[model samples]
Target: MSATAVILQNRFSNDGATILSVAVDGRMVHESWNHTVSTNDARAQMIDAFLDLWNVYCEQGLVLYVSSRTVRNLLKEQQELFDGLLIRDTITGAMFRKTWDVCSASHHKQRREKRPLPSEIEKEPTPLVVVATDASKGKNSKTVGLSAVNSCGIIKTHEMELNSIFDAELSAINFALQQFGKNVKRLEVLTDSRQAIQYIQGRTSLQST
Candidate 1:
């Protein structure tokens, strides 16, 4: 008999934090200060908000979208209110975790842009150079093999005395940076290590700032 459903999701973080907010139809309706309320207080607010919405739309269907298992169990305890309600994503933690997994499956590698030959240039500005670096660490190997290739077809490889992959990766990055002494303002270094990229970018930004 119910024609419309009020979609709801209770979003909160931590093991015992209060419900940060109740998203009704994708809009936050009732929100509590995070970690500032007791578990009892969280439940009370949830019940209050549900009852308020139910009073207005009880004739309509109720849909619950729960992303956390703890929050789902808490709501399940109120069987009287939860009866006849529709539920989606019953016991999943970390919303969008699966979606992000799918995203990475297809977006892991980026496409490289094509460049024109040096002879086809009319007025050449600053020479653009792109350096790609990578390291190989096989099992039972003590040394790391670091290699770098530039857009100008210049390739360099080094056997570093570093034992860990991180060390080898940093050495490869340094090799790329050392390719240009000065006057090369446009330099691009591509690597598979996200941690290295983040650290180098963060340090460079902090120094510039």
Candidate 2:
């Protein structure tokens, strides 16, 4: 019997965003197009991202085909992360696993070797310190993870407890900023929690003006 593998297609939306679809031997699968969950650009919320992938993975295995390297990388990361998690069909609430292929092509690795990466660019380190923060639920208490990298190549990581991921995002940002105190004159903070940003910027309804 021939192995059943899904065929995939990639295209650009009018807004220039990537739109991905899967097909079985030329027949399109619309069942999932309408079902892709709004992850709110989920990064800190791995569960939300995982559920989006699980929506389709429970069926025939997925084989993603993409034109843009960026889209390919995003899909690859999504697939790999979902691969790590023990998941269930969110709709059916049944545990399962499925195969995933990331932009597979014949002699693809060998082809990539032809174009070696250029030497590191010579430049002074950036003036701004960049920090990324995230939070997630833990067994006992909510957990927060903070990572920071400076122009000088210095890196640091921190962890702490919080009431919830929502709270963690806010607390993590403050913890990250205070890690170096007033020493960081120029800084850039990165976070996955939109609500946290809204609250901090005084744009959220929950926050009073």
Candidate 3:
């Protein structure tokens, strides 16, 4: 089986961005294209992007990143027409995991090959810090509690006032990042707020006044 992977990301309405990335040889070497779609209609933009990617990597395992559940449902409903392709809302899905693992291993191998022998100081590298953030709203009040917990058993909490739960969730993320981001090279943040994730990923946009 030929090891080929393709990733499609359609963000036309949010910022007119449409991206396609391809990798081969079980490596993360990517040949990517980014185009600014001229269309303003969200559904049309998504369909156009999907069709374009589908046409190019029809034989490869195509993975799509789209925020619209409607489009995902439509594609799911038509399984026979889009067989062999993986429709995903996030990069952590199975289709992306294999591609990502291949890329990561390739990069690490190249780095190891260039490094000197074991004559230098040998110490374990710092582990990646993973943080989970959450926010809870007070009953019949604007007060909110924001908490950030890390893998190291460290917990940080704050209480504040926010207009809505969405705001509180977003604020919690910002607070967590601010508290744990400094002087750290690698950090992973986990949150259960889908709306907050969508906002941070630029999949959902706020209306301008």
- lDDT to native, each model: 0.56, 0.46, 0.64
- For residue 197, give model 3's deviation from the true position in Å: 0.6
> What is every candidate's alpha-carbon RMSD to the true fold?
19.1, 23.7, 24.0
Per-candidate TM-scores read: 0.35, 0.33, 0.38
TM-score of 1: 0.35
Best of the two (1, 3) by TM-score: 3
Shift of residue 127 alpha carbon in model 3, Å: 5.1
lDDT of 2 at 111: 29
Q: Encode model 3's per-residue lDDT on 1-209: one tens digit a residue.
A: 32334332344235554433333334444422344545335445556656766776667656654445777677677757975676666556464567756644544443344443576436454457789999999779999999999889899999998888889888888888898876566889999999888887889885211
Model 2 pairs whose backbones collide: none
Clashes of each: 0, 0, 0
- Model 2 stretches astray by more than 4 angstroms: 1-127, 151-153, 207-209
Model 3, clash count? Answer: 0
Q: What is candidate 1's lDDT per residue for 1-209, written digit by digit as tens?
A: 43222222232345453323344443334434434346556555555666676676566666655444555576667757655665555423343334333322222211111222466444544477788999887778768898989887889888867667776777788877886423575888889987677667674332210
Best-fitting candidate, measured by lDDT? 3
What's the best-to-worst order under TM-score?
Answer: 3, 1, 2
Which residue pairs come into collision in candidate 1?
none
Q: Write the per-residue lDDT of candidate 2 for residues 61-131, one digit (tens) a residue.
A: 43333333444455566665544332222212111112123222312322234332355333444456777
